[model samples]
Target chain A: MTRVGDVLARCRAEGRAALIGYLPVGYPDVPGSIEAMTAMVEAGVDIVEVGVPYSDPLMDGPVIQYAVETALAGGTRVDDVFTATAAVRDAGAPALVMTYWNLVMRRGVETFASDLAAGGGSGLITPDLIPDEAGDWIASSESHGLDRVFLVAPSSTSERLTRATSACRGFVYAASTMGVTGTRTSVGSAAEGLVARTRAVTDVPVCVGLGVSNGEQAADVARFADGVIVGSALVRCLTEAPTRADGIRALTDLTRELAEGVRARRSTPGGAPGGASGMVASA
Target chain B: MTTPGRFGDFGGRYVPEALIPALEQLDEVRRKAMIDPEFVGELERLHRTYTGRPSILTEVPRFAEHAGGARVILKREDLNHTGSHKINNVLGQALLTKRMGKKRIIAETGAGQHGVAAATAAALLGLDCVVYMGKVDTERQALNVARMRLLGAEVVAVENGSQTLKDAVNEALRDWVANVDDTHYVLGTVTGPHPFPEMVRDFHRVIGIEARAQVLDLVGRLPDVVLACVGGGSNAMGIFHRFLDDTGVRLVGLEAGGAGVTTGRHAARFSAGERGVLHGAFTYVMQDVDGQTVESHSVSAGLDYPSVGPEHSYLLDIGRAEYRPITDVDAMEAFRLLCRTEGIIPAIESAHALAGAIDVGRELGPEAVLLVNLSGRGDKDVHTAAQWFGLLDDAALQSAGAIASADATGVSSLTDGVQV
Candidate 1:
């Protein structure tokens, strides 16, 4: 099993969902972002998704887009992604790079995989690179011992869902809505259905993202998903903060709240265990 | 023919999973519509009755003087209903949107030509239309913006990234992703994922088809060369597709070179770009070493994009077509020449083709029959053109007036004095 799988398994054993947090690698600057991610881990984030700021982030909303523009304006490079990943790994969590396909393709898939592996990254969460166009990445991730996490949306056909789940190495990323990433007032009702559909296809842990921002939302997704992923809300902590310390403090507070929220499902009977393992045994 | 959704190694659906089913649905609908007689007849009727298809072919002998006496024929797509060839694809897509039972349509534009065309089609069909244009383009092409609003379409000025065509496309895709169930993204050009490149190209193939038949009827032969400006390559693909089988006819695409390719401030993707993915298709994209899209500059907003259509990249690889850069200065000069000599105010995007024709005409010399796709009219570009040639400045306008009056007096000395 991959490091991400191990974390999910541990969370399942603990009767809770894993808390996965995301921050672009160079939002405030390289070191500041790495510090923020490390703080997230310290505050109880089980997994760290190091976002690679891209020029055109199509699936991103205003919050993440603003953070990305700030990161890019600071001259963030691909090398900084690895640097932040390594720092997150050192801080005690499996780090995965969430990036657009062009950056990976530009760096050469095999080369990017090897470098990520060297930096102690566990997997990748490709927002744009679907399984239909992931041949090179699939082979390269396998050869380099890095997990490839592809996303499934509410719109995915059954055939596409099977293909995507069968190709996944770490876990399946189930986007909570049919929209770009943002902190919505309410996560879409479609997330639970998509997770269930994905579970029917594969035993891979299905993580829910796109709108899980606060504690209550985390608890809500934790009822069905194997992991709860938060991005824009966590990034907003840094974006709205007046200083680096305030950003780090806000990130820590949110991470703790989310971590507690995921565990809040533990006391509720049949809440968290109904995810990957339970679904497979019942099938 | 080559592979479904592929032109060589370039075209494919490289997008979010949410868009895959939408693309597949679009492809299926496009295929059925292409083969459906009723659908084809409806679109054709719309073209004949509405868009003014078989846009006339005009020969510019006076303009040919700058081209070393070569004969230049223009495929006047500018005379179409919305004042550009963009009407062809927008009308086709709008018809398809209705067929899909969609109630609304979204689109992205650079110079606002496609937006205007889409707005026009949507108004005719009673579908809600929203157009995303770069903030910079909305200001520069404010007339087209107003035209779209007047046509009952909402115009959104995208404010991210370079604030040009590329960013507008990004915003449009985001909207499509969220509203895919009810809205059809009437993509403006032959870029984007599968089906889009092929489908948009098919919608525009009438340009070459008509121009070819017209040349035969007028010049008694197919032209030796076909030329069109390559923005997202809709018009180029439109005029180049039918002539692909004609081995004797050469296809050349002129790309915008804002300053010069070497200056790193131009949109000449084929001139300096490498193989990369952008706006959903794997094609030639102008990007930094880390694969971040670089800003593409062009005086003409239509051609100011960081990437070209995927088929252009494939055609370049196989050498079936040739692409060259035309600097802003050269394009504007051609723009002035066409206005003065042919009474044609060509779009700046189309003027890139005119600039290229001048060079090719000079090279091929007098007997060569060159067909250039006059993709759109210059009505939307009056502001930019005025600023470009300093006509907007009172001092420069007065100086030009003085030079004109001095030249009218038939006194070279007085003209030089006016310049001094």
Candidate 2:
């Protein structure tokens, strides 16, 4: 299985932003979620984030929370999440585990990291954990040779941006808006500025999420970001579908459109490696 | 004070990225305010003048007879402005909102005491306030909803995810995330992320401070047992903080055992809960094997939370305090005991502590002195209590001197002069 770093680097080499897709594990059920993720990978999603279902998802809006509640009701345990990650990895996407920090802490951080690595997961995205509180996780991820991804928001100060990007290994997740995860009619204007500000601190690839639902918004974010992440939109497609097959088809169709939109913005101005490196040098 | 963001392995900032800067700002401002005399002076003045501070300590000889003839002292926080200890934390946070220049305060309520207190503080401070309450709780405690509205606050009924306090908290958090710049989330209890448990505890510490001094004046010694109900543990921590260093004073927290622990329906965290994360605190939460939070059942809506405060978790861990569960039957029996013996109608939440005090007093013998925190008045629980005692029937209501429309002519005359 490919690492998330290699996927992003490959996307950069091709002069386009990576299309990262997110879905909770065991959403419809264990096998159903895996098949849906496989469909997303085949339809051109470069990186996949398999969320571990939690009861209280403070960061999630309605759509993903509903899906996760259903997944939990269907008995999606941590072991099932590992199984789902392995299946997604085998399906040809670098599967990253995105989850609340408690799920990892409850299972012992080292054990969780090792098990995810054994399941062929590339990295982790901790939505609620900040860089300052990630000491044990940093050590565990390093020991397990797994990526550590941290999030930055528009409200983050320069010091926080530097700390977050420095802590991140795979990519930095930039929340496109100052709210919970859901689709929005328009992405926050601060997202582009935030990406530029984050670039000034580190050369790590920056991905923007939280409001990218359709192809146009994906293309708009793709112009400035190293990766474009779509989560609630994909979950909405699956949740609003009448059947499992319809859900997979909807997810695949959306993934294909988003991939095309991200690829449409070929060779963004000053998007080359040197442009990112120049910002790092200036910093 | 021990550390900013942790209570042993229990508490930290486990919120979304969007609220990071806001939380940092709140922590910074709160730290500065703690040392500033003007802020301290303002809170003190509000307590003395507006909140009727230094709430009296009353000893009930008759009530003591029920507790195996042990001397019982009650710290009367129920006499506060909003009829609960919730007012203390609300006033402190409301002042903090002014210091931070936030114009709006949003809060979540379970039994509506916190909502009323928040609304009262907001009105006193002249800030816009909005409260989210569970739909079921709104029906149960409709008077509190009306009280919040009368105090010039907006009450939003939350209908999702069990339609209870947890769901109300989620909705309030969503509002704060969406509007963090102009809004301050007035979390009701000693829970949530960093600074909240610590900050709320600091605000309510006066309960212990005054009670300690008052008890020393009255009894010339500390209490043998200090007890309070532990729903999110604000009141327990408030009265327990000063007594913690007094090694002889046994601090006991009474959790609401709705039925029994054997029935899988109770809010007894130490007795039945496991260590897991919920509502931003890594505390003793009732959860399944898969880490999914199990809903807690308590006759007292205020005590129906699954997760407890992190500070309580730390105290329970370090052997500084002990927590026990009180069943609904025993609590209500204690509730009636206080009303009949001491002429004090204690909230059902507070009756749990009273019930624990009875058991502890019996165990410690007749010479022991027990200090129990009367956290709130039972005026808000009249309907629940009426139903519990089968006092809702016409005969029972009339026997209780509830009017039963005997003065219909006079009532009609008064309504005739008023607009419909």
Highest TM-score: which candidate?
1
CAPRI quality of model 2: acceptable
User: What local lDDT does model 2 show for residue A22?
Assistant: 95
TM per model? 0.95, 0.94
Give the per-residue lDDT of model 1 (tens digit) for B46-157.
Answer: 9999999879999999999999888899999999999999999999999999999999999999999999999999999999999998887876776677677767888887
Give the C-alpha miss distance for residue A262 in model 2, angstroms: 0.6
lDDT of 2 by residue, B1-420 (tens): 122678787787777667878888999999999999999999999999999998999898898888988999999999998999999999999999999999999999999999999999999999999999887777677667767777788888876676788888988988898889899999999999888999999999999999999999999988899999999999999999988899988999999898998898998989999887777777888887766778888889899888899999999999999999999999999999999998999999999999998999889889899999999999888868987888678666444323222221122222221211
Evaluated at residue B404, the lDDT of candidate 2 is 22
Query: Model 1, stretches more than 4 Å misplaced?
Result: A266-272, A275-283, B1-3, B393-420
The Cα local distance difference test for each model comes to 0.90, 0.87
Best by lDDT: 1
For candidate 1, the per-residue lDDT at B122 reads 94
Error of 1 at A103 (Å): 0.3
Off by over 4 Å in 2: A270-274, A278-283, B1-3, B394-420
